[model samples]
Target: MKLLKLVPDDTNIDFMKWRKIAFGISLALMIASVVLVGVRGLNFGVDFVGGQMIRVTFTQTAEAPVAKLRDTVGALGYGSPSIQRFGAPNEVSIRMRLPKEAEGQTGAAATMTNAIVGSIQKDYPGARVDGVDSVSGKVSDELFQKGTIALLAAMVAIAIYIWVRFEWQFGVGGLAALAHDVTLTFGFFALTQLEFDLNIIAALLTIIGYSLNDTIVVYDRIRENLKKYRKMEIGELINLSINETLSRTVMTSLTMVIVLVAMLLLGPETIFGFTAAMTLGIVVGTYSSIYWGAPILVWLKVGPDSFVPVGDKPGAPGRDREGYTR
Candidate 1:
């Protein structure tokens, strides 16, 4: 029986032919993403913005009283609480916004959190305050700073590694692709106003890794082709390399997206943001690896000669018609 093939054996697509179009679209989206982030800004979660997150479980109940809890918390003068079921139906995370007076005051935030917990326990005997997190303004700011640094550091380090492993041109291309993926992710958050937390940071890091992995696969093939196809034009060589790896890319990305889409539709509310971010990242990463990562090489003047030595002549002896030694 013939095996199922997503991308055929003789797959030959001219991805390079549309490099200009891809680059233009990427540039415009990147600029627009940057602008959205600057103007609308991300809706930082309690992890980044100072606040209290209290985890509660009702041991005897099948589901927590969301409406009553909202009213109870609201009546306590702590402002309206954002409550959502996380794990079991009876368990939930209650997020309370830190008041202006409580800003930078860890003691005040803690006291407020304790009071809310105390009120819930009194009102419902089954209520159990499992966890309480109180982050001060200063601490949240520090966390935000560290998260940004981690992202930038990871992207730069990946680029440098690709440069050493392949070529400087590949490194630039990889970095550009990473930038595109990350910028669009941030843009997504800015546009949706989803709560940006350390969890989302984790998602972004994962996206970067995915993007790098895919880009590396393509870059590796491109490098191999450069040595073998000395007579091939740069654009055509890159197109061939991408097509060669297209099957793996499609299968990997398709499976991943299928799982992510399922999670988005059926997963818990707690991981909704995380799943959503990753879903977008996966798609954006794959596109960048194909379009941005491979095409940039052509524009950067990469050719078969790049892999050849300074004094090596065309069709050197011992080399096959394609160029590499037999």
Candidate 2:
């Protein structure tokens, strides 16, 4: 439901002021994210970092305290284990990076599990070793390669689609805007050391889709305005196009942000990474659609005369209700 209107009318708004403010804000956030990325690296999950996941379940609700369980696992010589409550207080999961000595053993998975299980049993005899899984370095490498390929393929496909649907300049601007959003998101993730896993990849793709969709809306308006505002300067046309579509952009983005915020509050932790990334993307996407996307069209020499005619194109419509001919 529409809670409240976020943006007012598009008519007679200060285009230059808003676009400049948007650009400044986007650049500032992106730069801050980059600095953070440089200072703190991303926390790659077991899927990328290569580790073991140990799950334990107690027979009864009052079996053992979480602290006791962690202490038991810690004494096993597992280095820096991440302990978290899984399904319930009685269920706990711990993930730890295996020692370098167990790197390439043929049955490294079973060996690691057995070692951890033996240690856990020594402390808590009643705790059940629910499951143990090992992720090889080779597997992480494979996943890294596959995730890269998927992201590149998506970017290429989107560029091609936009180019085919609109002009070459439109496609280029759309891609630039997409890159801005992705890089900013990555910067934020890296700075925070948020676990980069399959879920993060999913979030990146969702951002790509969201950013591209925003670009398309603004581009559609630019295309329409080019035909209507004949003799208008390129910057003026772009600014006007953005202003014309501003209402729709804010409305659409606000709705999605509302849903995403709900998920952020009530969603499972499994989806927390994805939701957070998308939430940032939605904010950046909205800004880029008007600032980054439209500004690029101006830089590319796209002008009103490209779509409209001074007199008439070689073969196109004459004049219309707007007095602009295609």
For model 2, how big is the CA root-mean-square deviation?
A: 4.9
TM-score of 1: 0.85
Clashing residue pairs, candidate 2?
Answer: none
lDDT of each: 0.88, 0.77
**lDDT for model 1, on a 0 to 1 scale?**
0.88
**Candidate no. 2 TM-score:** 0.76
> Model 1: clashing residue pairs?
none
Residue-level lDDT tens digits of model 1 in 1-326: 99999889999988887889988998999999999999999988777787988999998799998878888988999675778887999998998878767766647787888889889999999788899876667888999999999999999999999988887999999999999999999999999988788889999999999999999999999988888777899888888889999999999999999999999999866678999999999999999998898888887999876765533655554543345553
Give the per-residue lDDT of model 2 (tens digit) for 1-326: 85654666636565655666777787887788777777786777777879988888876555446666666667767554666677866787877776668766777657767877787766666778788777778998899889989888888889889888777888888887887898898897887666678888988898889889888988888888777666778777777777777888878888899999999999755567788998998998887777788887776888765554444566655764346545
Clashes of each: 0, 0
Q: C-alpha displacement of 200 in model 1, angstroms?
A: 0.5
TM-score of each: 0.85, 0.76
